[model samples]
Target: SDPKAEYIGTEPWTPKEALEGGEITDKADIFAYGLTLWEMMSLAMPHLELLEGEDDEKEVEEDEDQSLEVSFDEDAYYDRLGTRPAVDLEALGNSYRRMVELFYLCTEGDPVRRPSAAQILQALESNVPLNINPSEVIVID
Candidate 1:
C-alpha cells in the first residue's frame, strides 16, 4: 500500500486501489500478466528473492547497460525466473499458443505495440495454440 514499500512476490499483486475500474487497462495486472508469460514459457512463477531487511532501494541494483537486457536462452528448459519451471505444452490446447504470443507481444520493448487489457482478452479468445511443444521448452536461464 505504501509506494515506498518494496514489491515482493514473483507475480504482481494488484491492490484494491489499483482496480478502481475507470481505466481501460491497469499497469499492475499488465506486470503480472507479463510475468505470467514468462511463467507459462518457463513453466514457473517468476520468483523474486525475499528481501532481508534491506531498504527497497538498496535491494534493487539493475545493470545500466542497454545490452544488459532480460532475455531467455530459449534452449535450456531447466529454469524460469530463477526457478525450475516446465510446462506440458502438449497438454495445452491451440488457444493457449495465441495467448502466450500475445503475452510476449504485450511485454515487448515498445509498449505501443503491446495490446491493452481489453484487447489482450479479445486476442486470447482466438486461442490459436502454437505448434511448439510446451514440453520441449528449453531455455538457458
Candidate 2:
C-alpha cells in the first residue's frame, strides 16, 4: 500500500457532510478503503480527466504544493463526473471491474447510500464471479 493511503480518510472521500462540519464515522473508513481498492486494482492511475481530441499532451493542471496528490475534487465527484479517473472495463476483465463497482457503493454521494464495511466484506466473501466468461459479463461503460 502507498504510504499516503492514510490521506484518503480525511479529504474528498471524507463525505460532503463531514467536510461541512458533520461528525465523521466508520463510513469514512469504508470510503477510504474503496478508493484504495481502486488504486490497487488500477495500478495507481491519476484521478484526472480524459484528454480531449488527439492531443495526448493535454493535462490536468497539477497542484504545485504537492508532488504526489490524488484528486480531491469533491464538487466534480458529487456532481458525478469530472473528478474521478476513467476505468477501462474491457482491460480490467470482469472480476476486477466488479470490485471497482464496489467503490461506487462505498462512496455514494449520500452517506446513507454507502455500504458499511461489514456489508462490503460479506459481499466480497459471497461473490466469486471473476471466473465467468468475459464475453457474457456486461460491464457498465
Candidate 3:
C-alpha cells in the first residue's frame, strides 16, 4: 500500500516532487503550466524523446506486417532526474527571452524556488524581469 505506486507512470507535465511521491502543492500547477508553454512553443509533445531510438525499430517491425506493441518504459524515463523538454529559445527569437525565463522559473526542480501564480501574473503584467540566476536556466533548445 504505497502512496507513490499510483504515480509511477504519470505524464511528463507532472512535477519532480509529485513523481517522487512528495507533497503536492499549488506549485505543481505552475510546473505543468510551464510544460504546456513549452509544448506550445515547440509544437512538439513533451517527453516524446523518451521514445527516442525506438521509432526506427518500430517502423521496421511495422513494415514487415508484424504485430507491433510498443510499451513506454516509465521507470527508465522517470529515473532520470531533472529531465525536462528542451525549448528552442533561438528559434523563438530574442523577443521571448523574458517569457522563456518565466517558463524556467515556473518549472524549477525545487518547488520551493518556483514562483507563485501571483508572482508570475505580476511579472507578466508589468514586464518585469525575474530575479532568477542564469545558471538556474536548465531548459536547453
Candidate 4:
C-alpha cells in the first residue's frame, strides 16, 4: 500500500482494496468513479436504498434523556458480501447503458481485472463493447 494513497471517502465509495487495507491504486479511483456515475444517473446517494431498507427493519426508541447510537461496519459488509450499489441499466436509457457497462468493469472485485483509465477512454471514444472476454461480442439481430 502506498503511504500517500490513503482514501478518506465514505464507505459506499471506497473500493474493496481500500476496504481491505491493501495497496491503493488508480483502480481504486475507478471504483469510486463508477459509484459517482451511478449517483449522478440515479439522483441518489450510493447504497442509500440498501440502507433505507435496513432502517425499516430496525425500531428506534425516542427518549428525552437517551441518545441514539448507530453502528455499522461498512468494511465488514463489503468483505463478507462483495456487494455493489444496485443499478438498473435499462431504466437509465440506451445512451447510459454503455456507461453502466463501464461501471461494472470499474468496480470489479479484483483490482487487476478492472480497466485502466486509458482503456475506458478508448472504449468510450471508439464505441467498443467492454466485456471481460473481449472475444465474446454481442451481435444484436
Best by TM-score: 3
What is the TM-score of candidate 4? Answer: 0.64
Per-residue C-alpha lDDT of model 2 across residues 75-102, encoded as one tens digit per residue: 5544542123456788888877667788
Model 3 Cα lDDT, one tens digit per residue, 3-57: 4433333477888877777766666777888888787778766775434454555
lDDT of 3 at 4: 40
Clashes of 4: 0
lDDT of 3: 0.68
RMSD of 1: 16.4
lDDT value for candidate 4?
Answer: 0.68
In model 3, where is the ten-residue run with the lowest total lDDT? 132-141
| lDDT by residue (tens digit), candidate 4, 30-111 | 7788778777888976664432235576444566778864444566555543346778876888988877888888778877
Across 1-141, the per-residue lDDT of candidate 1 in tens digits comes to 334334333323232223332222233445456657756665544443333334543243358664433433343422222222234557765757755565555454333344556566655576543232223221111
- Models 1 onward score TM values of 0.36, 0.55, 0.66, 0.64
Q: What local lDDT score does residue 100 receive in model 1, on the 0 to 100 scale?
A: 54
Stretch of 10 with least lDDT, candidate 4: 132-141
* Alpha-carbon runs more than 4 Å astray in model 3: 1-10, 50-76, 80-82, 131-141
**Cα RMSD for candidate 2?**
11.4
**Overall local distance difference test of candidate 2:** 0.54
By TM-score rank, best first, the candidates go 3, 4, 2, 1
